[model samples]
Target: MEIEAISRTYSPEMACVIFCCRVFIKTAAAEDLEQFVAYGDIDWNEVYRLAALHRVRPIVYRVLNNTNIPEPTLTRFRNYCRALSVFAFERQIESARIKQVLGQQGISVRMYKGLDFTKVVYGGDISLREFTDMDMMIAPGQLSAMVNVMKAEGYVCSQVEYLRRFPTNFVTNKKDICFYKRSPMGRLFGFEFHYRPTNFMMDQSPGFDELLGKDSSPFTHEQYYRLMVLNHGASDYYPNLRSLVDIVMLSQGRVVDVPPKLRRYERLGQELASRLLNSPAPAVPADKPLLKCATLITEWQLTATPRSGWEKMYMHIRFSSSFLHTLRLMLRAMHYFALPNEKDINNVQLPLFKLYYLAKPVRLLNIPSRLKKVFS
Candidate 1:
C-alpha cells in the first residue's frame, strides 16, 4: 500500500514511521520522506514514540537524521542510535568469544537473527538493527555439553537451574534455555541455546541437521526466511517493524518455500510486511478475517495501546489457521498459564504440583503493579 493509504488506514504518525523505516531497497524517495516531514500536522514526537515502541529507532534515525525534524527529537534518536551501535559492537565481540569456546568443545553452532541479520541483511550496519540476545541453534543431544561449556566460561543458566528442580517432563518439552552473563562493563548479555528451531507448541519443529542440511553449511536465505516466518507466528503475530524489515530484506530476490503447515502464518507475515513496508505481497491468499484481526492488533501494539487478556486471547484465536489449530493453541495457553512454573514457586518445592495452580491467581494479581513499574 502507498503512504497515503497507510495514513488513512492507521494515522499520519504511523505513515511517517513507514516512510522512515521502509526497507532500503524499496524505500520511498528522499523527497517523499521530506514531504511527510514537511507536513505541519505530522507529530514528530509520536513518530519517535512509535519508532521506539517498534524497536526501529535506529532505522528511523538513519532515514530522518538529514531531514528537517526538530533538533530535540533528532537528538534523542541520535543518542539512542549511537549507544546501540556501541552495544552492538560489544555484543559482536562477546558472541565471537562464546562461539569459539563452544567450537573448541566440538559443538557446532548456528547463530540466527539479531547480529547475524544485521550483517547479512543490513550489510554489517549494526546501527540499523537491535538484538537483545544471541540465538544459537545446536544439536539437541549436545545441549548438556553446551551448557557446561557456557557455565565454565562464567555464564549462568538460571533456566536450566530452575528446570532441574521441576519434573523431567518440563525439561523434555523445552525448546531452548538462556545463559546470561555480565560483561566487564556490567552490561548484561543473554545467549539462548536452542535445541529446536521453533517453539514446542508449534508444528513439529525442524531438526538441527535438517536445517543445516547434509554438509552443514550456513543457513541459506530460504532457511532464514522459513525460520523468520515461524518465529513471527510464535510471537502471536506482533507487528514489530524490525521483524517486518527482516521479512522484506530476506525475501528481496528469492522465493522462500515455507513448510505446508506454516504457510498460512507466512502469508500473514508477508501481508503485514507488504502493507506496512510496501514489500511484495505473498503469492498465497491469506484469510481475510485473520488479516483484519492481525491488522487491528498491530495498530494496538504499534501505538502502545494496552490490550486486556481477553482481547489478546481473542486475537490469538483469530490468527489460528484452523479450528483444530485454534484448539491446540488454546489448550497450550491454558496449560501454560494455569500451571505454575518456576516463577510461581520461586524454587520452593511442593508435594503436589497441582498446588501451584492455586497460587497462579494470586501471582496474576501483582501484574498491574509490575507493569506500572515497567512503564512508569
Candidate 2:
C-alpha cells in the first residue's frame, strides 16, 4: 500500500512552531530547545498563533519564558495562556469532587483525556496538561445517576449549541454524552461522559461486572493504555498529538506483546509523532510492514496547524492516512448527516421530532459554499 509520500510543503515558520512545541515535552532535552531558539528568527505572533491552535500554549508559554526571547512578547504570551493552569486546576478539583460523590453513591466513574492525561503524561502536574474539556466515562446504565450527581455538585444543565446544526449521528454515533456548566468564576466548562471511549476494533469496554476491577497498577491497567492509543491514532478521524506523546512516554523501554491490528497503528502513531514533532519517539520492530502512506496524512495535518474555527475542523476530519481511515471519515460524516443530536431532540417536540432526521441531508446540502471552499 505504499505510495510516494504526498508532496506536502510547510512554511518555515510553521515548522519552527512545531519544533518549539516538542521542546517543552518532559522527554525533550533543554539543549535542543536552546539550540533551535538560538538560530531561529521566528515571527512571535505566528508562533503563538500556531501553538494556540494545537492547544499547546501552556507548554509553548513555558518554552518562550525560559528562552532568551524578548520579555515583552513572552509576557504577552504568558497573559494569553495564563488562564490555562487555573482552569486546568479548577477542572481537576471539580472532577475529583464529582468522582468522590459517584463513589459514595455506589456509581462508577473513571477520568480520562484532559485531567487524567496530564497526570500520566505530565507526571501528575496540572499545569502541563492543557485541554479543551474534562472527560470521564461511566456505564450507560448509570448515565442518569451521573447527571443527578453532577447537578448536585453545582453543575447546571447546558446545551451544546453547535450540535443543533449537525446530524444526530454526529452526537450519537460517538456513544458519549457531553454536559456543560458555568463555573463559579463565570467560565464555561464541560464534562464529556463517554460510554465507549474508542469504538476501534480493540474496544473492550469494561462490562458492568468489571467496573469494580479498575486496575490501579500503571502497567497492568491494560484498558487505559489501549483506549489512549486507539483514540489518538487509530480509531479517530481527528488525531491528537498528545496521544502520540503518551505512546512515546508510556511505551518507552517496554516489551509488551501488542495485538497485530493494534500494533500497526501504535507504531504508525509513534513514528508519525516523532516525524512531525521532531521528537524522539519509541519504535516497533522494523520487519513489520510500514504504513508508508501515513506520512502524507501526518505531513498535511502537522503543517496546517494554528487554524481556528472551521479550518481547524476541516483538517481534523478531512485529512486521512489510509483507506480504512477514509472509510471511517465517511462513516462519521454519515453519522453527522443522519443522526439528530441532543439539540434537535430538545428543540423539536416528540413524534414530530423525527423530522430532525430529514433535516440532516437538507442542512448538509445547504452548507455554505465558503465552508466547502477548503476542499476545493
- What are the C-alpha RMSDs, in order, of all predicted structures? 4.6, 6.9
- What would the TM-scores of all predictions be? 0.85, 0.73
* Overall lDDT per candidate, in order of appearance: 0.74, 0.59
lDDT (Cα, tens digit) per residue for candidate 1, span 1-376: 6888768766788888878877354556878788877874787788888888777888888888888988999999989888898888998888898899899999988777778867777877876887799888776677778878888999987666445555354455577888899989999989988777665455566665554454655567777777777776544465577777877777888776776777677777777776667677846553776678657856764456755656656666677767898898789768756766667667446666577787677677876578899999
Best by TM-score: 1
The residue-by-residue lDDT of candidate 2 on 1-376, one tens digit each, is: 1111211255545655555556655445667666666776667777677666665666677666778877777887787666777788788788887789889998887777676766765677777745877777677677667767777776755433323334343334545667777877888878888776555223343332232235644423344455555566555523545555566655555554444556666667667766665555565565323444355546555665333434433433444445686677667555544666555556545454457787655455765565679678
Task: Give the 10-residue window scoring lowest on summed lDDT in candidate 1.
Answer: 161-170
Model 1: how far residue 216 lies from native, Å: 3.7
